[model samples]
Target: MDINNALKADPAPLGLAGFGLTTFLLSFVNAGILSGSAVNVVMPLAFAYGGFAQLLTGAFEMRRGNTFGFTAFTSYGSFWFFYAFLVIFNDLKIISIPGKALGIALILWGLFTLYMWSGTFRLNLALFLTFLFLWLAFIVLGFGSYYSIIELTRLGGIFGFLTAFFAVYTSFGIVNNSLKPGTIPLGPAILK
Candidate 1:
């Protein structure tokens, strides 16, 4: 699961898949982010899992030769890594500010991705709309007060489940050499 390793030797496609899967994993946390009252509640564990995974993945992403890979993985990784430090010690101030920060990030990422992908890919209207909803929803979710964003948080969690169950389970399984996802399998397995 070294994101920087570039397994297939094609970083763009593989890196994107990597980024997409990693992003998917974060959705569960994002769901938690949107549903839970404060970032502090989730920060303790989020830092280690999110931070270390990204740190390793980002390095491999760089090795994969993705210009977008390193920054995306590492920056997002660093966000969690530093936050882990703040969380373990009960520094609530950092948690207080991150919701808004994450919100802004969603807005920017959505905008950039929409504009970037809209014109390039032969994306169907349905696909385009899905992306639109996905990106805009988070951008708007960011607007919720950190304390009272249950519905919007639920929306984020829905996306998280979709992406996780559909998107990343296989890749992560490949990286880890285990089928710990239990009920969420991407396809029929050789074992079965």
Candidate 2:
């Protein structure tokens, strides 16, 4: 193998896994399958695995000149950090954020994800589906929080579960293919 290829590793799997697991845990709470107290369990996972690990993965992607990976991983990683801190500060009574304000933030994230979804057309189906569901989740959750609609929030949680599943599946496929090519399939890119 070339020195460069040997030195660099694929970071997508790590980033995806971190994002997926954390999302799954949080989604359970959002869906009301778990009580609010479950957030205490999710906070540290969000900070460490989803936030920090994905940040590291994004750095690796940057080193590999994968702009999409770098942007996606880093952005989501920062999202995790934001989420953890938001909950922490609220619990500590350090700061209180109105639901409407948080809703606006989520809507902004949805806007970002919608644009990012455009980039996914050149990628595999796994990534495309992941982004699609994520965008839907953000929009539904944003509106739900904004309007204080419980059903919408539950629906958003369902979307989050789908997003997490696809992300985790993509990560598994990539890792499996690395070990034994074609052992798993990530459907072809839509663009080419």
TM-score of each: 0.50, 0.96
Report every candidate's CA lDDT.
0.50, 0.94
* Candidate 2 stretches greater than 4 Å from native: 1-6
Candidate maximizing lDDT: 2
- Cα misplacement distance, residue 32 of candidate 2 (Å): 0.9
**Which runs in model 1 stand beyond 4 Å of their true positions?**
1-41, 82-102, 112-137, 146-149, 170-192
Report lDDT (Cα) of residue 33, candidate 2. 100
Q: Write one digit per residue (lDDT tens) for candidate 2, span 79-128.
A: 99999999999999999979899988999999999999999999999999
Work out candidate 2's RMSD over C-alphas. Answer: 1.6
Q: Which candidate has the highest TM-score of all?
A: 2
| Candidates' RMSD to native | 8.3, 1.6
